[model samples]
Target: MLFQIEDIITKMQDDKTGGVPIRTVKSFLSKIPSVVTGTDIVQWLMKNLSIEDPVEAIHLGSLIAAQGYIFPISDHVLTMKDDGTFYRFQAPYFWPSNCWEPENTDYAIYLCKRTMQNKARLELADYEAENLARLQRAFARKWEFIFMQAEAQVKIDRKKDKTERKILDSQERAFWDVHRPVPGCVNTTEMDIRKCRRLKNPQRVKKSVYGVTEESQSQSPVHIPSQPIRKTTKEDIRKQITFLNAQIDRHCLKMSKVAESLIAYTEQYVEYDPLITPAEPSNPWISDDVTLWDTEMSKEPSQQRVKRWGFSFDEVLKDQVGRDQFLRFLESEFSSENLRFWLAVQDLKKQPLQDVAKRVEEIWQEFLAPGAPSAINLDSHSYEITSQNVKDGGRYTFEDAQEHIYKLMKSDSYARFLRSNAYQDLLLAKKKRGPHAYTHTSCLRACVKKAQSQVNQQDDKCLELHLRKGDQGEYQPCVCLGIQGWSKSSKGKSLAGKRLTGLMQSS
Candidate 1:
């Protein structure tokens, strides 16, 4: 496709009389999907080996425009005679003339045919032939008109007048012969074509007065050749099959060489040896050291409990199963209304202002009102204020209700939640079977076994806790929040032991 366009452009620029008309070039380009503009044609040409010099490229571009292959049009302006205002307007088309005929279309078609013969592959040859056929058809449609135009141009060239050369002699004669002429005055006809200071198409005598010939008026019309359609034969089909088979064989040989090279390349660079290591490989089950839970184990029980539940708010929101279990626990205690209201208020806050009022009314009717379907325990005064607020609800009208619900859950429902069996079971299950737990439990077993073997090296001042065997036959270590001064006093040791025992039993 690219070579075909370059061929057309080369033929066009090589024309001595500028180049083909703009519409003829456009019509040729319309057959190909790739060529769009004169610049596209030039840039494609510049990449070719033949168009190496910058001067040739510059010359080709100049010919494309100067030869009427591309014509530029400007905006038309209108002005008000009364005022100084002017208006610029655009027309649908800017084409001032219709000259679609090309002077050397036969040479362009010959270039395309020569390009097809240069290609080695049958498919490419057929493609170029089809493109040439299309161009031929385009020419055939306007052949009669093009022939007439060429004939007209030929006649015009043949009848070139010497009026400009005779201007001085005609003017002198008219000056001496015209009636009532001022000195050196010449009639309009006496002036040459260059200096004709007369109205355009001035009145003239009939053709008989000038002795014009009847043969020129009765000249024969041009005859255009008819395009023929060729039918396919069996020999042509067999020839195409032979070409395709040869192409396939050539492609297969190239692919075989490529595959052999790839195999040799891989064998040269790739390592295929077995993996060998020095130590008993560290357990793959052990995890990286980042933990969401607070791992600073020495804090007081009350403080630890606060951190766990505070962090659990995000956990519950993130973990769908945990949230569902929490909601179920709230349902068991008949306080699910608090969670429901909180969730609805969260959704309401995200809604548009127009939607918030409707959502506020729904929440009040469904959960906040006295004897409502899932009524929450609100005081009578709070209930009345909330109902009135819902009636006059703006975007933030639900704020007070959401806050009241949040406080109720954190103080009453959330406190009970921590003590619920569902909450304790979640912690136990996560500590035992979770991915992090699998690694954590493995680490603890290793640490405990190592501690037992090096009992003599164990610091006596440190609080020592007992080790217990888990269901998987791995010894789990009792992790103590390293409390200072506890192992020094008997009372402190007793209290620490009790707290450590409770923590182990709870987990």
Candidate 2:
């Protein structure tokens, strides 16, 4: 698409009347040469491309400018404006059609040359200056060589005519503008990964569409094959058969191992599986009762819930109570930094984009840097990768380090935690109240029925004895007296009922 658009732009440049009017513009002190107004470019695009909307034409012009076909003469930003903004055609040599893959060395030399020039127009932008500093540190070993090359280029550039130098400098800047564009500008030079792979390993094209032989097309001398093709022998066939047999055996062994792992996992968790074993307090989905969920969320978890933590390290970390217990265990062993670093990395992934860099730096300083307050042990490879990634301060800067710490905790600390007395005691501790324990509403209903049975039998002693345990406060005195109302005379019963009602309301 870019190449085709560049062809159209070339035609537009060549046309005299229906094309962009190119001319030199005299500024306050100097002449801006071979530049066209952005308005002229937009008008030409709308006329030739049959585009009705001026905005569309301007957008097309911007796309062409972004691809380095044209650029603003005075700005690092490669964009087209539908006003009097001056844009100059980029040199054909620097066009993306040439597959210009500029390297860091070339970029460094260009930046260095800009620094040598005392012209105000050649001053680097803030981002460019920062990039130059970083490149210098990266290529410190070859700094002398790079400096010499930049000095040589600057000397040659000075020899050119002033107008010619201005054109050349702007063209070179535009090339970099397309490659390492301004921070927000789109980098048009970035190729698709699929296209890059195709370029690496291109498929052969058939020369003749009609399937004609190459020898018939042009009478050339026939050449012998580079290497002699040999027929397959019995030994080769037998070797292939043996290789196939070995592959089958290996596949079978892998299948057996997978089956064994699945069986072991199923056995370990079968008791906790709601489908295999009925839920202790009934599954909420199957029954309307939410006793199972309530039990799981309780401050003092049930034995079954605690037992699930022992099934895997992930399970232990997943449960709040279990994770707190594990953290305590880690603190006792003075290795809580591993879990802390792991959790910090997890949290870093969820941070807002604006806060990600700050949080990344905090995590690195707290757990990964040299002499860090709570440094966790990391292998040399992970440490090196993390150290390099910390410079960017991205969200995933600690991915490798986090993975290493997680594995360390799972293999060492998690196993030890499960075996620790703290965890074992929790798993063995009997729950004071089970899910089916009597609630206050249920107890109240049972007491009411017992009192009614005693009242019908006219056994006041039995009713009082059952309702109140005298000073022990087994039941409320109001409830005990409330039942006496049913056994007394009509007047006594009315007085008793009023008294009980008052007591009940106050209580």
Candidate 3:
């Protein structure tokens, strides 16, 4: 559609009759060159396309302008209006039909060149200024190169005639307007969602009986007669039926295996799932408590949490306590280099682009170099790949080696770590604490009693309160006399009872 409209626009730019009047429009202080009025464009569209409605012609003109065949002289918006607003035809080289997909570097250079120019007409817009700043940060390492190219282009542009320069600048701006339209404007260069999906996962092309592709067949100059369709025979039908039965059987077997795997995984992790199995100390979000989070952050791991480490190597590494235990186990086995190498590779991925080369070299020297102090084993294929990658000095220089070591540790070292005494000791310690040892009520009671003892040591006459189990299995307040004699007045007893109740509730 864009190509078809551009062709019509090309004909409309002709100097002969039927073309829109192209002239210089003199404003207050400046002359706009090679421009046509929006009214003239709409009238030409209505006359040449034989459209009876003026509204339809204006609509068509707006579509053409949005596609960047032409643009208004003084607006960032690319829309046609039925008025005397001046518009210019974009240069043929800048037309969307040319398939110009400018990269960020090109845009950055153009914006940089605009900054160097002193003319107000070439000044960057607010959004363009923001884009330039972002591009500078993104391409920081090569910004010097981009600036040099922009300078060279600016020098060349300076030698062009004043009128030609104005036209060229407007054309370039319109080209970018189509590619990176204003925030509210429709971006004409954006592909349809369906087209993007088709590009990502295209269907296989059909091939002819001669093994030529359908596209090639259509483009071929030689004429070929179509072959008659062959009739299906009973033997072919039987073969197809047998093949389909086999496929069904295989599919059923695959589904059954998948179902079993899912069931096993659920059973293994059911205890760890807070929703299915109630969390110890209650869920924080539901109960308005942070006990569960506090327990996880503590140095000691719970028995259930430690047990989850056996489920997967990733599970073990994800838990800080479990990871520390595994590291100790590896150190005892003198194979800690594998874990260290894997950690270094992970960190390398996060390094900035300018620092990647330095980090990559350091990682290679420490992990993969021959006779290195803490070298780990790697297969010949991975070692060779790592060697080549190290020469390139990229962030993933040891990706293959890291992956190999990870699988080795997960299959061998991780299994042994689960059975090691260090991990079993942690699980046993947590198990001995049991569910009753650290109940919330017991901890609160202990804190209240400790406060009571501190007060008694300071003032021996201070009242004390004790919490006792009630009939409903909840804590009830009970007054305990201090070292002083009890008051005999009814008012004194009532005040003491109220104080006891307050202490119990606060605890």
Candidate 4:
């Protein structure tokens, strides 16, 4: 019955229906990756690799942009930029191959030639009959040239290897000639060969042949862990903003101090009409000798001082334009509205939550900073704000405001604070289990154990308390302010005993 149906199916099938021609699965697989344009290649590469390391991927990708399909990362993977133009800002890696027309793909042809020319020859994958014939001939011509050039290089490498192999005891250099797959180069893809041949075809094997042997059983796969943390959420944004605020404080203080120092240095070098006095709020001392005061002012400072830091401002009044240039710069960088918001809540050790909320809203009205109550980020979903502004002792609670800010951050795709390296690192590291996508739990566990064994160089006192473990799984290590007390007391033998007991209980 099966034979009869098969016979009818084959005979009656239209070109488009009933049954497809019997071609190997490899044929379909080969067609899957589409050619991509240089721009599309870059965009796809950016998406595929870690966004945090976009620039790193671009370094390798640019080669494909320069020469389409000339260099393959591996035999299974091909890269090409559309129109075969090397472009600035194009990421050449991980592009779909079909979007590009694969005509003139000299890079791939060059590689084929280089392979055939070398003593270490490789098989070329056959394609269409006519094209394949042309490619094979082209490949043979290049291959001959590559092998001739490589003969000289091979002799040099072998001589060098013979001298160094005694010290290194590595068989790698002796086994294969590792060269870039460029025309006229001896090249090999040993790592890729291992990868391509790593697994057996399960369909051909009727039973668990791997389990039958002790050697096979011993070769249990030990997975390498990728970064565990993959996605970021509102909680992650809050953590990011908390870190940003700390950075803002540090940056602002440093900026203000530098601004003042620069102003003092500038007034001495550039004549400021004697009106821009370095000394302000001074009771001018009357020297016993008027000549002494005159002499002190006349002689320039003992050393040449370079005042390149920035301008200075003693005070900034919105109405006073000239004196407040420095303040204006600061205001431009960190808006006046943000200043108002900070001023509203900064001084008091405690403030009414409602009042704080109102002040933040007022600031939001003046400026469009991320995570503000009235913040209208282009990326954010619009939500109505209450009419009442945040006041010093207003009705909304601090926790409520914090949650609102967090929600605002989550809704906006382009929120700067969330995308900052520090936050994204933390977020992605959490998603991938560690820093890379392939990171697994065991690698992380090993890292935790290793970190626990290491000494904390921060203190000369107790070491045990200073021992920090990466979160039992993938959370990043951060020194908590609360660790001081525990770290301070870890020197005692009693602490070691407690640690042992805790470990036992945990186990």
lDDT of 4 by residue, 391-488 (tens): 33332312233334435333432134333454344445444332221123554566556445532334324333222334333244332222222222
TM-score of each model, in listed order: 0.28, 0.41, 0.44, 0.14
lDDT of 3: 0.74
Query: TM-score-based ranking, best first?
Result: 3, 2, 1, 4
Q: How many steric clashes does model 1 contain?
A: 2
Q: Once model 2 is optimally superposed onto the true structure by TM-score, how far is the C-alpha of residue 496 displaced, in angstroms?
A: 45
- In candidate 4 the C-alpha lDDT for residue 434 amounts to 26
lDDT of each: 0.44, 0.74, 0.74, 0.34
Which residue runs does candidate 2 get wrong by more than 4 Å?
15-18, 198-507
**10 residues in a row with least lDDT, candidate 1:** 73-82
lDDT string, candidate 2, 27-85, tens digits: 89878899999998888888888999998998988888888989998898988899999
**Candidate 1's residue-wise lDDT over 1-507, tens digit each?**
323434455454443644422221223423211112434434444664368765676466544333222222110111111121111111112111221111224322232324333223212233334544454445544433434543553344346544321222222212212211223433212336454334333232112111223222211122111111345578767856676666566634578899998887565434321133321113233534333233224221222222244344544544445456668989998878778877777787678646877887888788876568987776666667667667767444556566777777777777677788877766665455322222355577676554455333334356654454455554545444442112323354544444544565665
Colliding residue pairs in candidate 3: none
Task: Please give the lDDT score at residue 103 for candidate 1.
Answer: 22
- Which one is best on TM-score? 3
For 1-507, candidate 3 gives per-residue lDDT tens digits of 776897789779876857998999887998888999999999898898899899998999999999998899889899999999999998877776555545666677778888888888888899997788677767656776777878888788889998999898888888888878888899987777677556632222222321222322231122112222355578767856676666566634578899999999999988778779877768777775576787777787767888788788999878777778888899999999888888888889778768999998888778778878898899999999889767768655676788899999999999888788888888887665444223366566784565455431334466554554433364444445543222234354444445444544553
Task: Provide the global lDDT of candidate 1 against the true structure.
Answer: 0.44
**Candidate with more favorable, higher TM-score: 2 or 3:** 3
